[model samples]
Structures are given as structure tokens and as C-alpha cells.
Target: MTTLTRPLLVTLVDDYDVVLTGLAHMFDDYRDRILVSEIDANAVLHDAIDIVLYDSFAQPESDHEEIAELVANPQARHVVVYTWNFQPELVQAALDEGVHGYLSKTLPAKELVEALEAVAAGEVVVIEPKRRAASAAGLDWPGRREGITDRESEILALITQGKSNAEVATLTYLSPNTVKSYIRSVYRKIGAESRTQAVLWGVGHGFTPDHHRIDHWLGGP
Candidate 1:
């Protein structure tokens, strides 16, 4: 591991406040190594940031344009994608966009800090897939308190946006069968009998994203 003179200045980027806040707290134990400078939803990047960790919750995994925009930003020294999806195409696409790291959400806080330290030292990091029974702790998402896993909530969010199962699978890099399985789980947990009812429930809850990160950052309409 690279020894830093000081803690690396990091920023968390995502549309959901809950998700950002949870990620920020995950590094609380490793404050000496990695300092979360800010959690941004729509704010402009004014200060210099060593790394910007883009959390890919409820977002299309293949949105390379947004990643490219982030890479082009001068204030962001390095960009890293923090996500659960590890499809080879998605990884290659993100790397092609000049991302410094493509990390998994399944990584624990300590390992996450280590990965960031490696990125700070100018090494491109790509976390390999592991057979994890559960994702890392100290993370939160919309409807998590209501027993909805992050993946399930993401599926519901896409469904709320009127995405068909096939579209959801495409965007999330999951199989169509996996998408259906997640939908079934979501319906069971939310007491919904059909797609319409599930969409209604998702609408009532916080399934929709507040704004797109790049648009909000660029102050576009």
C-alpha cells in the first residue's frame, strides 16, 4: 500500500442523499487514511478533490457520457465508479471513459480505503468479483429500512420510471430472469399484486431520483 503524507481528499457523488450519507459514514473508521471531503448531489465542484467516487445507485450502468464529463472536469483529479454491476462491457466502458478505478459496492470500508489509497498512488484499480453472501455494511439506500435490498430498490426505481423488465435488466447488467426475481421480491415486500400496484407504491415512496448528477452539476435545464 502507498503511504500518503496525509489523508486522501475524496468526494462521494450520487443522486440520493441517503446513499451519499451512508457512503460518507462508511469511511468514518478510516478517517486517518481517507477523508470524505463532501457528498455532492447537485452542487458545483469548487475545491480540489483527489478522487470522486461516483455511486451508481438507481442509474444505468452504461452511462459513459456522464463518466466522461466527470473525467473532463479539472477539479476532479481522478474518477472512480462505485457500483455493484461488474459486467465486462460495463467495466471496459468505464475504463475507456478514463476512470481511475472501478470498484465494487461489496467492498468493506477498510478495503475501500485501501483501494482509494492505491488510486491516489496512480494505479488503476479494478476490484475482482467475489462470491459475497452479502454486501458491505455501513451502507444505506432508499427503502432499505423497509427491507428492500439495494438491488431490489434499484429495480423498483427503474420500474417506477416505466422501464420494462427487459430494460431494467439491460440497464442494470442483470439477466432478464434476475430482473424478474428482483421484481417479485420487491412486490412481495411492498404488498403489491401487480406491476401497476408496485409502481404506485414506488411512486409513493422515494424510488425516483431527484436529478441527474451531470445535469445538476452543469446547471443545465
Candidate 2:
């Protein structure tokens, strides 16, 4: 049999032991190719883990910084977060942190498995649009997202076309960090909280076109 090398490693943290144990078990079946570790909240893993599924442990955690740090790490290219609930703001925060995948505690095992593998392969996974957000609270772009200068708008348009940041940096002749910063600023200004949100808001506001049709975002500024 052809064996997969390097099991996908995961770390779990939660206040409830039972919950942590159950999670460890659920993912235990992949032991041969998926190593699972349950660790204390304060642990900063020395070896690279395939993903981390965590919740409150010893203290109230700061979400964005942690997620961003993981994404920023060369070893954490495939960071995935699993949470008990999907809060739009929190979920968006993870996206801004460059998280690769996220699934609510209620996601089906089959789907979760697919998501884990996808993220491990370096693809980002997005959750379903929040019910309320679709109804009304979705997002609003009051004016041009504040931090984005004119040059940044040009870059944002490129990303909307599915271009990678590196590709954008090459095209714009700007540094990768500059591109990332622009995206973050756009997110902040539009109350976007996420890349998807930034895209939706930009398209909604006329920075990017719908591409579905020729209708103006809000039919005009």
C-alpha cells in the first residue's frame, strides 16, 4: 500500500475535557496520516501542526492577532480554525488573519474532513453567508473604504479578479506587505472584517463590478 507521509497534525484546546476528548477521538481515525494533539491553551507549538482547532482554555483569547500570527508563520501556511459557533465578526476576523479554513462545530464530519484536507493543501475555505447578514446586516460600504488610497483601489480590483497577492505585487510593483496592508485597510474602512466581505463591499460599492451583469453596484453613488 502506498502510505501518505507526514500525518496532518492538529491541536485541540477547550475548557471542557469531554469536549476535547470527543474531538480528539473524532479525528483519531486519521492517526496513521493525521496526528492529533490536545494541548494546554498557553502552548505555542514548537513543531508545525497541520491545523489547530481551539476554543477558550485557560484565558479569554484574542482572536485576530493569534490567527494572523499563524497565517504569517512560514510553517502555519495551512492554519484552520474550528469553532462551536460562527460569529460574523469573529469569522471575518479570522479571514483577516489569513486563516485557511473554518467550520462551525455543527459542520458535518464529511464536510469537515474535506475542509481539513483542502486547507492542508493550502486552499482557503469559506463558510456559508450568515443568515442575518443576507437578510439585512450583511455589510455596508458607506463611502470609499477610508485607508485605501487611489493606488490601493487599483490593487483591490486585481485581487477581485482572483489574482494572488504576489501576482498583484508584481503587477502593481508594490511589495507584498503593501498589498496585504491595503487589503486590511479596505476591510477596516468598509466594516468588511474579511476578504470576502471586502470583495462584496467593493463590488457592491462600484470599486469592483458585479461581473454577473452590467448593473452598477448601488445603481450609482
Q: Which candidate number maximizes TM-score?
A: 1
**All predictions: root-mean-square deviation over Cα?**
4.4, 18.0
State each model's CA lDDT, in order. 0.82, 0.54
Q: What TM-score do all the candidates reach, one by one?
A: 0.89, 0.48
Per-residue lDDT over 121-145 for candidate 2, one digit per residue giving the tens place of the 0 to 100 score: 7678875534422111111122324
For model 2, the local distance difference test gives 0.54
Model 1 agreement with the true structure over 26-118: per-residue lDDT tens digits:
887777677675544446677778898999888877667677878888889889999888888889989988999999988988899989889
Top candidate by lDDT? 1
Off by over 4 Å in 1: 1-3, 39-43, 212-221
